[model samples]
Target: MEEQAKQKLKNYVLWLLSRQEYSRRDLTFKLQKKEASPEYIESLLDWCESLNYIDETRYCEGFIRRHLAKNHGYARIKSEAGAKGIDKTLLAFQIEEMEIDWFQLARTAYIKKFSNITDTPDYKQKAKIVRYLMYRGFNYEQIEFAYTHNQS
Candidate 1:
């Protein structure tokens, strides 16, 4: 490849990466959209990886941290990462590494979504909260303790 062509691809990759952390798959797709040649694209990607300009493992860890901070559940994160072409094994490992109180995450989301829920002692109200939590990717067993414990 000509030096000029290689530089342009590298520049595009650098610009795309400078915006935010991206999965390798995301970067590849974006570069392809730019019509970069297959050879330059592959070589450029390899160069970035070698230079540690795009570390997918670090990107995964950061993505997990940010997504969890947004109160997203394991299911949503798992599925989202899968869509990004992240391997199931890596997703599982990252989910395991979260090491967070998922109940608290669920509780916070529940409270935020239904602040008026606990004001009344209605079964229907409780059921709605339960359903909401489930929709947010929480397990019934995990949220059970929060529901019972919150009453006191």
Candidate 2:
């Protein structure tokens, strides 16, 4: 029965992995929620790690790629990835290695949201645009560049 329970947990983990990537922390939380023993879950996680089934680096890379495609900035991606149990240092390193064009992405996000407005915005409108960009994860410098460059 003990062996059967472990096999069941392993099979469930494999099925979940087949559907999507999960960080080790996320997987642990998930298995815990299923009422599995902590020691058993830890051992299973170790096995998964040994088999390369739950790699933090791989999960972080994929997460970054998906968020980048959505035009998210570094701050937003880092925040979201952290919530998803990714390590901040690893995420920062990956972002640096990728050499992402944050300015360009910010500009793209700006255009996508405010494409209809061709003329320079007034003070109130500029404030609104800045707020919107900020919420979308762009920094002040990037937001400034996006609006100023796009207006001209």
Q: Measured by TM-score, how close is model 1 to the native structure?
A: 0.86
What is the model-wide C-alpha lDDT for candidate 1?
0.77
RMSD of 2: 1.5
What tens-digit string does per-residue lDDT give for candidate 1 at 66-126?
Answer: 8787787787787777778877887778778768788788767766776655555378777
Which residue pairs of candidate 2 clash? none
Candidate 1 RMSD to the correct structure? 2.2
| Residue-by-residue lDDT tens digits, candidate 2, 86-133 | 888999999999999999999999999999878888898899989988
The 10 consecutive residues of candidate 1 with the worst lDDT sum are: 143-152
| Each model's lDDT | 0.77, 0.90
Model 2 spans > 4 angstroms off:
none
In terms of lDDT, the best-performing candidate is: 2
